[model samples]
Target: MLAFREFVRAAYPLLSPGASITLPCKSGGGGMRPWLMLILRGRTRQFVNEGAIMDTIERAGFEVACMDEVASWADVGAVAREVDACDVLVGAHGSGLTNMVFLRAGAVVVQVIPWGKMEPYGEGFSGALAAHMGLRHVMYSIAAEESTMYNRYGEDHPVITDPDVFYRNGSNAKFYWREQNIWLNTTRFAPTLQMVKRMRRE
Candidate 1:
């Protein structure tokens, strides 16, 4: 596997890094607030209800900011500097999660897990990456109703009802990764934000 540092240095060159995002809540309720950097996906897969995510974060008592650079192979140093400023880096399972390397030590990496492929790509992979970098890792498993797949395939489709059946092969696995986007069930996901807020204190 390519080293995390090496992968970050060579991300796409077209997209420009967005304005530095910062978290506003620190500790459970003290010290400088911790910032959450939500890496927005520019292409197909996306956080369809981003406002809800920000609202949930604020409600969880952490300052949060969204950014547009994760898809771009932009300036690595600039991205690193901005990531270092944040206390948490949150993104869905995708290349953008690679930004975990830039996080400050003890900062949290919160992965919004995608469907079917949740185990390896979503939580397991990055949890290992976070540990390798001395960072904390958390996962928000998207509920079936929250996934676009639920609507497209309807609740009965194998992918929606039995993801294990859907992910039996590599081609189907790719479909899960490429076609699925999340309409986060913020009510359920809020606890995850609260979890990250608690992690910020330590």
Candidate 2:
């Protein structure tokens, strides 16, 4: 996830305040919420990183806008308001889904996912809704960056064993890691590019 924050900085050097972000309101959930939101807002804001990637987004010129991380519904409302104020709502997979509540009707959402796995059934529905609602649902592929699994558990893990495919590899490699090059391009990322292009046109 820190890699993502670095990538955002390296990719977009002209970010600004209008580029607000609503972080996930987790207490100790090993999520990218706190750090990312703080970087985007330029102040302490009120999100976590638990001490992760903030300098990178700052270097890129964006600011984080976090809401409270209290144990109540009011905190949710605050996060929602912060999300609604952004031009783009950037988030990790599951946490990104939560941002939907805060997002203004047509705000663009960029969802980050691991590199090489088949797209899940539910995500397709979300994409369809994004298309219909004029909200851009961009997919950020992690394959190119080499982020497979984190030491701590999170929901963004790739589902590798589908009966027909065995793995996302178009090849017959016995292991998923061995077929990385192929699966990274064909399965893990093509649809993400497709989604981005589709959203851009919309």
Candidate 3:
């Protein structure tokens, strides 16, 4: 992790000189609390009720920072710096969760698996990465109704009822990967936040 962080610093000459890339709230100050970095997706697989999730995060006593609001991909250093400061990173299954590499060891990653049978992909993508980086990983798999797919393809539709049969053909995978968005169920998601809190405490 130190080697990778150094590689990032060396690669980005424009990064602020002497910028301390360290996790905040580690020493127990007045502001000591888990700093959560929420990744926001504007296109596909977005969190429709992001505001409610933010509310739940705050209610759980985490200091929230939206990824999009903190740094753009254009500035790798800025992204790394912001991520380095966060003790927790939360996002739906997507490319955004790749930022886990920038996080320090022992930080927690909460990956929200979208409603299809997307658990395998979520684990293969971010979950494994988090584990390899020595970070705690939590997965929140959404129910059928929690997905916007429920509205697009009603309750009885094979896509919602039986994803295995629906995705038998490899060609059908794009529908779930590119065409689905999530309307996260905050009621179901709140417990996941609490789990993260407990993991952080441990």
Candidate 4:
């Protein structure tokens, strides 16, 4: 997720009206799932209670689109051209479509990695491939500092609490970060499609 954070940071400076922010997803939910649940369930109001990460980004005054929401995933080749035209690309989890589009277009991509939940995307291969391809290292999306977890069992008590203590109660589980590197920041052009292909073959 460090890679994603750096990407965001780098892109943040470049972001302006009409900038493209490509968000990749497996269906709809990605690493932003947990936060979504919290907002929907009235557990938290962070990010302005946005329904999804894409929504939040859109509210930030940037042009955002989801690859999964497009006509078809197979059409990524054509879609990549569109992604390339964007100012920046933001992807979550294994990077899925974002990696493919960015690599093909030789555009900047920011990938998010979850801490606690490891979604392997063949870092070695992608890193090497992107490097050879000249993808830029941007930002990362690691665990946030001062992040707190909460329990569902505590109705009368605070719904949100520290993850450490909440886990002890055997209730809800949440992840919190304080400037941590659970996520990796990377910049590689032409990500290793072979690794992604290999994983799919598995």
Candidate 5:
């Protein structure tokens, strides 16, 4: 924890004392939380239809905000605050989910994973992170047809069968990360967004 704070301090030395990102405390001018934040990862894992995703999230009744690990200038303090304000944190299976350590209780962390057996990762690492942080975990598994990998290596490649070995090699992992992108089927993704929206806020 000390190491993480030090990293955050180094990365964002400019944070104001009260700096924070917040979802509106009321929705539709009513007494209920008006806006919820759905943070999309646009950095390491590229989403083919980013606008479509934002639209889907908005249509599901959430007010969406996006942060890219590579692109955004948002500092760790801001991100931690966003996680505190956020209802759902959306991203592919990656280290971005590690930021959930700042998430508030009952919030959701949605991990969108690839076709190659990246399970337990969502259920293992991110889920455990959420559990430890008092946050909820959701998964968005990319189907074979939805994954670009299906077209590149066919279904029988070791990339599909023995991801353990394939990923163990740095070059292979780089190639896989560079080439594999998920084409999300928004129709299938909306329900989960709605579920997050309706989840009782902490």
Candidate 6:
């Protein structure tokens, strides 16, 4: 990771200095800054209450940066520099979390697990990789009520009530992975942010 970051820095000399998106911290004092990057998804698995989530992050005393706004994949060096500047990377389970490699060791990667028994994928995809990279891994599993799936399928539907059976066929996983977006209950998610704050301090 260190070598890759150095290479990126050498390759994109200008991008290294000004890649961060500056947002005011709610907390007045600052020393070793803790940054929280929220990975924004355009099509699916978006936070329906993203404003509330940002408020929660600000209240937790970290400067928040929206991923899509700050970095573009077309420029790998820019994306690496942007991510490398952050102390915490928060994103739903997807290809976006792959950016964790750019993060320094001891930084936090908070993976938001969507509904439909996606724990294994969440753990396998990014959680384990975060640990492998010496970064802390935190997961915020979306509660049934917090997911759009609850409203679409109802309380008793197999997708909600029996996800294992619903996902027995491999292709059926797309309904959860591609078709769903989240309405995160910030009240429930605040604790996870608090945990990240504590981790950053330690």
lDDT of 3 by residue, 39-87 (tens): 8886888888878887778777787777662334867667777777778
**Candidate 1 on 65-138: residue-level lDDT in tens?**
66674433665666666776777888887788887776656788988887665767665578887887778888
> Alpha carbon lDDT of residue 42, candidate 2?
19
TM-score of each: 0.80, 0.44, 0.84, 0.39, 0.70, 0.84
Q: lDDT by residue for model 5 over 79-114, one digit each (tens)?
A: 666655555678888777676665545667888877
> How many backbone collisions does model 2 have?
9
10: Cα error in model 6, Å: 6.9
lDDT minimum window of 10 residues, candidate 3: 21-30
Task: Give lDDT per model, in order.
Answer: 0.71, 0.40, 0.76, 0.34, 0.63, 0.77
**Ranking 3 against 6 by lDDT, winner:** 6
The digit string of per-residue lDDT tens for model 2 on 1-202 reads 2343334334433233333344543233332332223212212111224223333333333344433323224555445445555545554443235444444444566555443453452267455555555466666645433332222223333333232454435442332333232112224433543354344346
Instruction: Score candidate 2 by TM-score against the native.
Output: 0.44
Q: Give the winner by lDDT.
A: 6
Estimate the lDDT of model 3.
0.76
Clashing pairs in 6: none
Which residue runs does candidate 6 get wrong by more than 4 Å? 1-19, 22-33, 69-71
After TM-score superposition, what is the CA distance of residue 172 in candidate 3 from its true location, in Å? Answer: 3.4
Model 2: pairs clashing at backbone N, Cα or C within 3 Å: 34-47, 34-48, 37-64, 39-64, 40-63, 40-64, 41-63, 41-64, 115-143
Candidate 1 global CA lDDT score: 0.71
